[model samples]
Target: MPGLAASVNTPFYQQHWQQIHLPLLKQRQTELWVCHLQCRVPAIAGNKWLKLKYHIQHIQQYEKTGILTFGGAFSNHLAAVAAAGKAFGFQTHAIVRHDGAVLNPTLAACQEQDMQLSFVSPQQYRQRQQSGYLATLQQQFPDWLLVPEGGTSPLGVKGVAELQLNNTPAGAADLICCATGSGGTVAGLALGHPQTAVLGINVVKDPSLPEQITALAPHQHNWQLAADCSGLRYGQFDAATLQLCLQLSQQDLPLEPVYTGKALQTLLAALREGHIKTGQRLVFFHTGGLQGLDGMLQRQRITQEQYQQIKSAELRLWHQFG
Candidate 1:
């Protein structure tokens, strides 16, 4: 873990998962234990760290020159890559969607981390896996290890499976829930905690999300998905969604709508729908995406005031309601 080496500024610890008992959960029959991975490291924290852990090691194993990965405008994955590259001595390249040289906060931060920016149109990025497309990139960036979008390789799965919960009050979790983007996080969780039933909240409406999870990690213990909780579609957020994000942020679980926020919303909705039975202990994985908030505000997915409110919530306190 050279990236998270014993540096004074490293917010992440060797112990990746921290169990926090929300005061609100005690009121209900169901118990909620949140594993806060969002603030795992000073930068490049959260579930992305779990996803990219082995990839970085792969780069070291192969003695690769650099890493090239794919992402959207405000991709937390790319930001994590940039941060990781900075901490480690590897070059980073991002094949991002949107055909512009705009130095948005995310991209700018990547640039600061010395990640080379490569802009591709949405259509071209969509064809990223189409035979000649990848071949061309291989030819152009020879010697570069191309990490798949969201860094969801088998090695990545192996890396994420290493993340375990500590300080478990009553031991194992009855249910583990996470936001499903590329299905890597849930796949890793399923593989790691086979005894626990895992639920994935679809942040991106992919009809084939389950299939993707199956492909990444073949398992039979339990892999369930909860859909229609992403505020209509991917990268879109509503006022209520923003409010929930703020609420969670005030509780020390900062999240953005693209990933973590949607998962929380889905969990609450599941509770309301009676999907979560009483007396069951739930462990929710807080996949980080604080870097995406600026992009969300810029795109008007969330208002400026809403973002500010989330940032300035020191006075807000959590109260348990019965």
Candidate 2:
């Protein structure tokens, strides 16, 4: 990232784009607007950018030179941290929640970004929040700024709050929807726009998700969390989820299970169950997780070649990373 080609510019901050005329949007009869946050930055796009938006600012604000964060093998947060550290001139290290030697595309890509990897047992990873655990890390890497798992710091909420909803769908949205990871994005969004109902479709089966997001939100805004539509749970999908992923990908809406797909499935199920009113406009945020797709495919025992053969129709545009 440091001395990268000039023509290969990836901006840390850029203007958001609004896309319209997608077929399903019309059929839904809603003023649907999607912030193509994926295109905002090539590496740290979508909620990853928002999550790290203020973390980077915090590091710079404190005049730090190193960063430390936590994640699993397929963590989007870890990937973003690695990319941000390389692009913005910081030493980055990832405390991965895995044991033994693990070689995968996500970690490989992080290495390509010049991120240092440290493998830890799942139990140790869970101790990330304990005072003594953090103190040990502080003693080990005294200069590195420690970021929580999923980058869900209070600063992260502030970064997500900076996202301004465009006037195009400004007052028209009856329900603003997004996929929840660390719950920072939804908290920031709900705090930023308190009037609209925020329906956050959670990927994991955690029951405390709502309380967690509510506690993080600066304001107790109108919001709801849907945990029922988890389809085969996080990182595990069934025939229905695969079908939905295929359907959305064919429409140029790439998704991964940990976030986007579950949100989409929840929304569609809501519409089908008549939980949403006929005239209500549902603004779905496409929080990009294309980076995790290949990892999920491999975890499902499908090779990249097999996925390519299946999505041949959508391959051309896939190169664009849309």
Candidate 3:
């Protein structure tokens, strides 16, 4: 099967103190208010069950289809491709970055989805967009169909555009926010609807993102990019960001520390600064990454004593109120 891991977890709304904490924080802010919009990506196998059923159906219509290849060891794209391959009877190959020494949760989930994984050097990985690299792979697996990394090809973008169009609320919103790893989702959303403004918060700390996004969308002007420099290093947490993540999660808007936490911070800051006006409805798109939170929390150096104190304080507060 060429799709995301079956064991891969999805995020759900749960009752937690973090959810409660956020509303209090919002109350502190005189200008900014928060609103959340939920959207679902394709399942592990790159199959958009609702819209892309026809495409999957078409793949099934062809008997000679062999393999589907894409990028990201821990990518939802990999999981989706793997699932699609397994369900539609196509071979799946995941070309991953060489530096990924240990299998992260997402990768583990992808493996569970039954995708064959291959690692390549960082230099070779850079050549992923080149025709020569793809040519070599095609020569090796003559019948394989190459799907670009993050599924950013025309077909993929089309399906993504449809998803964005369908999920966007009926009325006007001040901003539609999402975390951008590959620019595909943002690009598709930008293309589908021109009326609303789309803001992408980059989890990756690349300074060149503005140029990169512009290259991907040269003519589009309504799109904006907000980089999460708080997590200066990838997969590493900063104290302030972790605290914010913990607080936001308590607010009924549980945000993953890496991407959404930074986004929430940016959104709130924008609201406080009057960047976005009051009564201007904003919609935040939550791209799922709950597994990453566990990895981040595990890396924290907090001692048992510190954890106990925090827990004790929280319990005392609850008891006083209740």
Q: What local distance difference test score does each model get? A: 0.74, 0.72, 0.55
For residues 223-280, could you state the per-residue lDDT of candidate 1 as single tens digits? 7888846457887767677678787766655667767777887787777667788777
Q: In candidate 1, which residue ranges exceed 4 Å CA deviation?
A: 1-28, 38-41, 99-101, 300-304, 312-322
- Tell me the lDDT of model 1 at 295: 72
* Model 2 stretches with alpha carbons more than 4 Å out: 2-28, 38-41, 99-101, 169-171, 300-306, 309-322
Sorted by TM-score (best first), the order is: 1, 2, 3
Model 3 misplaced stretches (Cα beyond 4 Å): 1-73, 87-89, 164-170, 206-219, 229-231, 294-322
How far in Å is the alpha carbon of 128 misplaced in model 3? 1.1
Clash counts per candidate, in order, are 1, 0, 26
Model 1 TM-score, all chains together: 0.87
lDDT of 2 by residue, 78-98 (tens): 888888888777889999989
* Inter-residue clash pairs, candidate 2: none
Candidate 2 displacement at residue 242 in angstroms:
1.8
